[model samples]
Target: MTEPLHSGEVDRAEYDVERGKIREFARATFTTDPVHTDRNAAQAAGFTEVPATLTHTVVAGHQREQRKFVEMLGLALERVVVGSVKWTYLRPLSAGDHVVGTRRIVDDVQREGKRGGSMRVVTLETEYVDADGDPVVRLEEVLIERGEQR
Candidate 1:
């Protein structure tokens, strides 16, 4: 049996934003913005370095925490449904920024499913802070899990 998940800190991970990674992510996401790939372009735009694509932090290292959270909740992959995802960027993320993200379960709710079994709504929020301890980004995900039908 898996332990019950509470509204608390899950884990923390550090990611080093690399320029190569930024370019690769940009290409993968079909982002043709030169600011994401060329430091010269970014500098011309008044940025000190290449800025990551808007959604870069989503792939920075948050998925590991999400997987761990899912395991802690005793959720099977097949039964886990991602209801929504939201991202909040407090500052521009650029290559060479060392970011530390603290993942936490901010909210958990249990309710009886209208169709059959019980339902659980869990919200996981991760806050990424830079080396100076300034908040850089926040990622939130809502997951809905339903129990086996009776």
Candidate 2:
């Protein structure tokens, strides 16, 4: 049997920020703040450049980056389901900032079920930081894996 993914090692991925992404998101999400849509306004507001709104963190923190763990555990991608995505913003994620996400499996547990047979509950966390090492946001995601019978 293949062992589950344990916590310790970290996976890192660099994300590039695009101006249009933030602008389009802001327009769609009804963010009235020009700081998100205009570079000049963001600079005047003391940010290095135009910054994305709160919800935009989702793009930078997607679970696709956690595939390393899924592969390590020899788990089939089809069986894994995303349980939740909780984001804690430490600071603003700006457009000009070079960002990187450091991902890790924070929690793992197994339980027996009457109907489903067995289940594994895993919690993964990805912390985003700027090139200067400033904390941007922390993304906590949960993934549930079930037994073959179910």
Candidate 3:
């Protein structure tokens, strides 16, 4: 078992939204909301362009943050388990908006388990901002058993 892990900051990554990508995500998620797939419908809904759902933003930016966090830990990918995820949307994300995401380690704890033996819980908070520098979303991802407990 390795030593207890410490928290660290991870660099951000920017993603440029593409219409085709939005449409594909909408289709795969079985989202029938016109605002997510049709530009006209979105504008009619008071948005400048097709607006992506909050869940869609996970793939757009948060996923990249998760990958970078894991890589920074120098731990094997297979050893990490995403225990939970929660997010808050500050503003709508449109199909053509560019977003940058930054992540910070919020907490880390070690506990002795009854069956899983020793375990560690790591929490990370990520913020996403649009091209205009406005906050778009905030996400919290909890990675459990990411490394050795001892």
For every candidate in turn, the CA RMSD to the true structure comes to 3.5, 3.8, 3.6
Candidate 3, residue 83: lDDT? 92
lDDT of each: 0.83, 0.77, 0.77
Give the lowest summed-lDDT range of ten residues in model 3: 60-69
Q: Which candidate is the best by TM-score?
A: 1
Please give the RMSD of candidate 3 to the true structure.
3.6
Clashes of 3: 0
lDDT agreement of model 3 with the native = 0.77
Winner on TM-score (1 vs 3) = 1
- In terms of lDDT, the best-performing candidate is 1
TM-scores of the models, in the given order?
Answer: 0.86, 0.75, 0.82
Q: What is candidate 3's lDDT per residue for 1-150, written digit by digit as tens?
A: 344467667667688777788888889889998888888999898999888866776674544655665677654677678899998888787888898888877777777666667667777887889888989889898887744544
Number of the candidate with higher TM-score, 1 or 2: 1
Model 2 lDDT at residue 43: 89
The C-alpha stretches of model 3 lying farther than 4 A from their native spots are: 1-4, 60-68, 114-116, 146-150
Clashing pairs in 3: none
* Candidate numbers, best lDDT first, in rank order: 1, 2, 3
Candidates, ranked, TM-score: 1, 3, 2
